[model samples]
Target chain A: MSSGEIKALVFDVFGTVVDWRTSISRQAAEFGAKHGVTADWDKFADDWRAGYGAGMAKVNSGEDEWKIVDQIHRERLEVILDEYGFPNINDDELTEFNKAWHRLDGWPDATTGLTRLKSKFIISSLSNGNIALLTNMAKYANLPWDAVLSAELAGKYKRHPRAYTKTAELLGLEYDEVMLVAAHNDDLRGAIKAGLKAALVTRPDEFGDAKKPDLEPDPDFNYFAKDFHDLADQLGCD
Target chain B: MSSGEIKALVFDVFGTVVDWRTSISRQAAEFGAKHGVTADWDKFADDWRAGYGAGMAKVNSGEDEWKIVDQIHRERLEVILDEYGFPNINDDELTEFNKAWHRLDGWPDATTGLTRLKSKFIISSLSNGNIALLTNMAKYANLPWDAVLSAELAGKYKRHPRAYTKTAELLGLEYDEVMLVAAHNDDLRGAIKAGLKAALVTRPDEFGDAKKPDLEPDPDFNYFAKDFHDLADQLGCD
Candidate 1:
């Protein structure tokens, strides 16, 4: 470890470690029920999540200033609140409900697999989500991360080379020594391009009935696993 | 939990969470034995740590460029190496030795108390140490941190208003909701000046007979306790 290398296993949070789609959908349904607004709650989750990409893209492109994922979610939440017949929700309620992202449910393998991997590697989050959101979700989902790192710290979102390499730098690791475990192929590709190792942990239910998931990894990826447990097994974690 | 507040108990790592002086002194004695040189290892720890303030103050005052705590420690280690009769140590060996700070031993109450605090509030590290240093130290010391935050993230060292306020902002909490727990009154005062709550957790043996410890808190501080366990009890964490 003297060559500025502290081996780390950084993770992508949203769909890989946590089942955001189902978690948000379930919460949205309950939120809708309380407000007496009954639309397709799953679609609402989708629409709200859709803003995330555009929000990050704008910031990355210099079209907008940097904002945390919580603000991004709130921006999207407000748009869909009116569109989805949730106009009566007060500002305070809206603020509380926006944290639904921070209360996501981790996939069953997430916590235990991460714990196992953490025994050997410096395990942390490398998500586009802000640190606050990731930290809160880690506690809420019991995803025992050694550190809660995020694109917020790097000031860049996923798929950006800076986002991938900066996270490795923060862990005092060479890019090659840091492995990114994610559900998205593009994120893995981004990691590879940034000189970090990549492992795709597929989540087929990530999109629910909304969109298809990325089940295949690119040839450049170092490993591919059905879930975090399989990844941990491949990584030789007990 | 709404209203931009996620209550957190952020900690000052060095003397508050870990017994750095004794740990560094003990490691330095072993280092000296290997190098065939001997001196007051405790004094060496003190001298090496003394450079920390000068390093951060230079950067803070814009007289020197930004550098991490690791680099600061490295600079200090190199100077003390010559004065303490270990001039033959190579750069690689020096680098490894500098990381002794990253492997400091946690206080008896550090781990258990943090685990208890984590049960109710988000518990993280709020140190002047860099993210890598704090993260690695957390691993070495078996300390549980929800997030590894630092003055490095804010590009300001502790005792700076930005360092205190920025950490709270990163956690998506108001100043008052994020309490800074430290073994030093100056740090607690810094947090209070930044509008965050403060708690003083004394480490009477912090300096290893080198200097006096800060056992008393300011009148404005929210709490004072003997150790993390006492702090935990006072904070109402089960």
Candidate 2:
């Protein structure tokens, strides 16, 4: 569990590093305002995210074919726009709005903490987000990733062993040499099952009352922290 | 043709950025001195690189199964070691020597020029080098790549359309928005055929006296520069 043994730190982006719920809700609220429509922004964010997990799960289970997260978001947006009683939007407008996911605001500790961690380890995103989403998010949020990797590269979703192992293999490191840092216990557990190390980072407000955050860590988890800065401090990163 | 239109610039790494020939030759010369052996180091570098294109082509043509560049390099090293009359080399010893490619020395303009270009556009290595080789080289040579993309991801060799197209697709850029910057005309031509923009950055000393450098650009190339710094200048990178 020593820092010296760890070669890379792969992260789950949506809730771990970026505040997707707040960011998405805020963007949706703004879009709704411009269109003279008022509705529950939090509900919109949650509904959008619900589509993401369901879409990915279907792809993972082979019930649906492979489609990028962008496509999934677009598909759900079309459905939800009708449910919210919004006027019909053009394809161009819908496409630009769909890219709100790319412009997510980072968690308060994200940039500063990641800067500290970058001094010590090769930090990268191991999200289910496609490469384009992760890459664009890195640029938009100024997240200094040494690499932007995704489960799309492995043709599987997170929680799958291939996704975790493929990332380690691409980095040319042993599974134990890479650590998955995330806000979810399930993701950390999956990493551990795949022979990779894990660190639990709690994001208490991630779901905003709609869903419960995994605030506790497994006994076997290497580290647990309130945020990225706390994680940096615990890991001895500058 | 406009700088703003270029979303990503994919680089040819070996000689264009890292001086692999000189780096490998120097490392090999040092290894030779330690072992009390001597030969033309430049020829040694050429011989080592000679196996690379053919090895990748075999995989692309389905004549051989998919293999990473690390394996290709190792296979070449075994043949060259015996030809160069090295004696009593073990598996571990050969592996250590094979990683010389991973420890290449960057050209003087590489780091600064790339930094300048990166400020204006997404810059990544589109070399035939596997992810591990490119990642280790980035750390070793201090190349600031936005991403370390490789032909390894495409499961094909360069000069094949898939290699160039897959890189652009992975970056989520249109083919025309992604530019291939390389010293080799054939590589640029391949990229152009695949609908990507092409920039010819000439490295006159890439082949030394063993072969002629790509001193002339193809008529269809969008930009031509004397070196990486010149390329940056042409691209209007600050």
Name the candidate that leads on DockQ. Answer: 1
lDDT of 2 by residue, B34-122 (tens): 77789998899899999998998899889999999999999999899778887778787888899999999888899999999988888
- Colliding pairs, model 1: none
Model 1 bad stretches (over 4 Å):
A1-6, B1-6
DockQ of each: 0.88, 0.62
Worst 10 residues of 2 chain B by lDDT: B1-10
Report the C-alpha lDDT of model 1 over B1-238, residue by residue, as the tens digit: 4343438999999999999999999999999999899899899899999999999999999999889999999998888889987858777788889999899999999889899989889998999999899999999989989999999899989888999999988998888898999999988988889988888988999986778999878899888899878877877888
In angstroms, give how far residue B118 of model 1 lies from its true place.
1.1
TM-score of each: 0.97, 0.95
Regions of model 2 farther than 4 Å from truth: A1-4, B1-4
